[model samples]
Target: MSAFAERKEMIMTKKTAYEFAYITFAMFIISCSIYFFLIPSGIVVGSISGLSMVLNQVINLPISLITFILNIGLLVIGFIFIGKEFGAKTVYTSILLPVFLAIFEKICPLSESLTHNSVYDLVSYTLIIAFGQAMLFNVNASSGGLDIVGKIISKYTHLEIGKALTVCGMITAATSIFVYDISTMIVSLIGTYANGQAVDYFVGGFNKRKRICILSEHYEEIMKYIMEDMNRGVTIYSAVGGFDKTPRIEVVTIMTTSEYKKLLNYLHQSDYKAFVTVSTVNEVIGTWNINKNSRKSKQKEVSVQ
Candidate 1:
């Protein structure tokens, strides 16, 4: 094989390994929340697992069985709609979640709330599940439940993942009304809201980037530093100074937090008196750091990776 192909395969293999490692850890976390906290406490956080809990009350099915069956159905839908990478990762995590729950039940079953306080249970489940979901969402994969629905909504309607999840979660929360008491149902709804908020917070922080605009006499030097040294793309725009009407070149680029920090440090050390503006961008669309023609099919949707 060619050297380039060998290197490319190596990189992909490493990335795949990392992705599955992350997926496994994320599933373990979600399963912990569902089996130990959500089940015993009767607090539903509005995912498929949450719905399974309600269904388990009516049918004689275990939560793991309900979740496994529902996830298998959703896996087919997810594989058809979403890209293969996402679908594949979701498959692993979705199956792993139920397996984890089953094992947890066998090894150490909790018949009562770990904290004995519904409020504490609600907080624990919300925080743990949100973090787990955010981790999967960050990798453009989900734990396959209502997450499949949320991802579909996000893909078609262009809604943020958090907002899409909130919509699905509210529906799941409403279902609990029939099975749970008024107080438990109300808590379920609140937990759903908190879950969405926490997911948004984590996803936003994970995907945040800096949109930077720089104007300076040494603009070419700055541009060179960005493109050649940092291996990032920059756009050059011709602009006129508003006050003086003097023509100038502006360098615009988007970078991660660490990249922005490096640029700032470079500027300070070099004593470059550059006019700079920075904005936090929560989402970026289209091709980034890749050839436009290569990603024409994905240009319309947001690139989570």
Candidate 2:
């Protein structure tokens, strides 16, 4: 291959490796939550695993085996109906989760609750599983099972995936009433709601950005810090003060939360009188590129100059 082609191949290989690593870690977290807390307590938090839990009571099969079979069936459905991309993204996670659970069971089998309090177990497992699933979603993947159903519903109805998943989860949680007591069923409903909330929280946080507007006598300093130190782009717009009728330069920039915090601290120390307004930005689409390695080299060049 040519040099450019070889480099592109290398980049693609690295990206695929990174994606698999992330998915593996996320699935492991889900498995740990299920094996340690959810399974033993019978919380039934509403998914394929929850359904497997309910089925295990009657079928006398291993939860891992049940999850594996269900996920395999879902994979076939996803491939046929949803699309190839969804199926490819979900296949590894769907299979790995059950394998991880099986390994966990072999290493440390649990006949009783890890904690004496069922509420604590439910809360802990709910949060862990939700966060892991959120991570998977952020990477454009899923844990298979009912998520495949959610995807199918979303495709035909044009519904949001979150709403679709919630509906599916509620239905799965409702089935818990038949297998467990009323109290368990109630916890399952609450866990389902909490799981959705947790996913929203994590996903929102992952994508959150800050839009900052600054009207300052020290616009040059602020702009320099942002452009040079932070390696972020800024737009300078001319503005006329409404009260004073004075011409001014307004500096606007978008940055991640950590970068915003650092900029805030720098502004406080450098220009205490600088007027600043900040807002949470849900989405940003632009051609501006912020490459960390390139930024670091540029910073070093600036410092040397």
Minimum summed lDDT over a 10-residue window in model 1 is located at: 292-301
Estimate candidate 2's RMSD in Å: 4.7
Clashing pairs in 1: none
Expressed as tens digits, the lDDT of each residue in 1-305 for candidate 2 is 75445655665677779888998999999889988988777667789878998899989999879988988898999899967867898988867977998899899988898887889898989889878887887677888888788778867897655677778888999988888888878888888878777776776777779999999999998999998788788999999999999999999999999999999999999989988999998656564434454456555656766
Candidate number with greatest lDDT: 1
lDDT of 1 by residue, 152-192 (tens): 99999988888899999999988887787887778878888
Residue 204 displacement in candidate 2 (angstroms)? 1.7
Clashing pairs in 2: none
* Candidate 2 whole-model C-alpha lDDT, 0 to 1: 0.83
